[model samples]
Target: MYPFVRMFYQAWKNRNAPKLGLFESHHSRHVCMPWDIDLWLELNNGRTLTIFDLGRVPMSIRNGTAKVAKDGGYSMAVAGASVRYRRRVTTFQTVDMVTTPIGFDDKFLYIEQSMWDQTGECCNHILLRGAVIKKRKLVPPKELFDLMDPTLESPELPAWVQNWIAADDTRPWPPTR
Candidate 1:
């Protein structure tokens, strides 16, 4: 598998150095969870967005133009995602997952995705926090933030966003997009 945030995080924990791109024994899997794809797809086409698009952001940060960008309103930035699994999921089976944007201050945008199988049982839940950066700064660039305004109103946000924000009590950040 290729080197990614999670794999590198684990490598840092294990005292294993990273090899550029991918390594045999260092990384195992790099599959994008469904929810992330949905947002990116929606951001592009707004009509035909799907789970496939949600999983493509890591590779699309640059040299990938959004399908629906008008001029320079949107651009890719730094971000990271983490997922927990209870059972193995095969690509053959389609799953139902609801996603929503929970919050976005200045640097971080939090999104939650919940997956349920055909039987209506929760299979996996994931939270993705993306930082919108430009030229290595923590502030959200004005142009990109304008594009994200339409996205913030998406119904995908789960019902528990407020609670999550309350629980998320991190370091005080008074700035925002």
Candidate 2:
């Protein structure tokens, strides 16, 4: 149910777009309605991660990191993800999403989304792992890239997202089943 009016009309229609730098790529565009299908009708692996939060909140407001997490009080979450789908999107189809920012280490911030289709293919792909909270603690994506710019930097995290962050650091947290 969280479409929040298409994520507030895609954060006020990309709030003037343009910015994006920490590995820029915020393409947007979507569709597949009919309640985003399921029951074998297509597109619905958990509503494709809740429609990828309408393309990662307009790619975090066109990469200004949602205004440096709303002026540093901070609050970005998605602590982990890793989707893949390959095809099918039925109802009104459309797609074109994109979203980037594939770097950061001192505690999360690593994104990558896709979802092409309309002939270009790539029906799905995700790899998020964000974080930055502040008062509730956990806030170190290089301090949200030193509050959004500080000469940017963060570019190395790739070798397959550092082997999926070293295989999610050997998993095993409380799941002995």
Candidate 3:
């Protein structure tokens, strides 16, 4: 189940936050609720991804991408993602999440997010490839960017992210069983 209530809370909490530049980061805090745990009693890997949406969507709102998407009648979708889990996040533990737009290419907008424990140790990190869509068809990121700010240019993507992109390109789609 999606954390729709928590998502609304996050959005409401950040409604008055200062508008951020396209590449700026959005900082937020969240707790690992009982339902967020797995059989091992740690944050579930799948739930971690969903919680990431709590950060990304609000970040987009603060950065004006949400407005652009709304006014243009476009929707944002996650086309791909890669996550790395390190430390354990147990129930009731709080974590600080940072989300930032890494860059964009011709097709997709890239964003990075990480969750850190109160001790400042990173528990997990995720990289997302997002797409703008209209009428069920893909829309170029540049089109979205143009609506947000014509002068906005994508920052250089990190080499690791580029490598990940290159690697993903080699994968067969409609994956073989």
Q: Which candidate number has the best lDDT?
A: 3
Better of 1 and 3 by TM-score: 3
State the lDDT of candidate 2 residue by residue for 79-173, as single tens digits.
98988898999888888888888788788888899889888989989998988888998867888777666776788887998998899889987
* TM values, all candidates: 0.43, 0.31, 0.98
| RMSD of candidate 3 to true structure, Å | 0.8
Highest-TM-score candidate: 3
- The parts of candidate 2 lying over 4 Å away from their true place are 1-13, 17-54, 57-59, 62-65, 75-78, 85-95, 98-114, 120-122, 125-130, 139-171, 174-177
- What is the overall TM-score of model 3 with all chains considered together? 0.98
Worst 10 residues of 1 by lDDT: 20-29
Q: Candidate 2: lDDT of 124?
A: 84
Error of 3 at 167 (Å): 0.6
Q: Give the lDDT of residue 56 in candidate 3.
A: 95
lDDT of 3 by residue, 1-177 (tens): 899999999999999999998999999999999999999999999999999999999998999989989999899999999999999999999999999998999999999999999999999999999998988999889888898788878888999999999999999997999
| Positional deviation of residue 14's Cα in model 3 after best superposition, in angstroms | 0.5
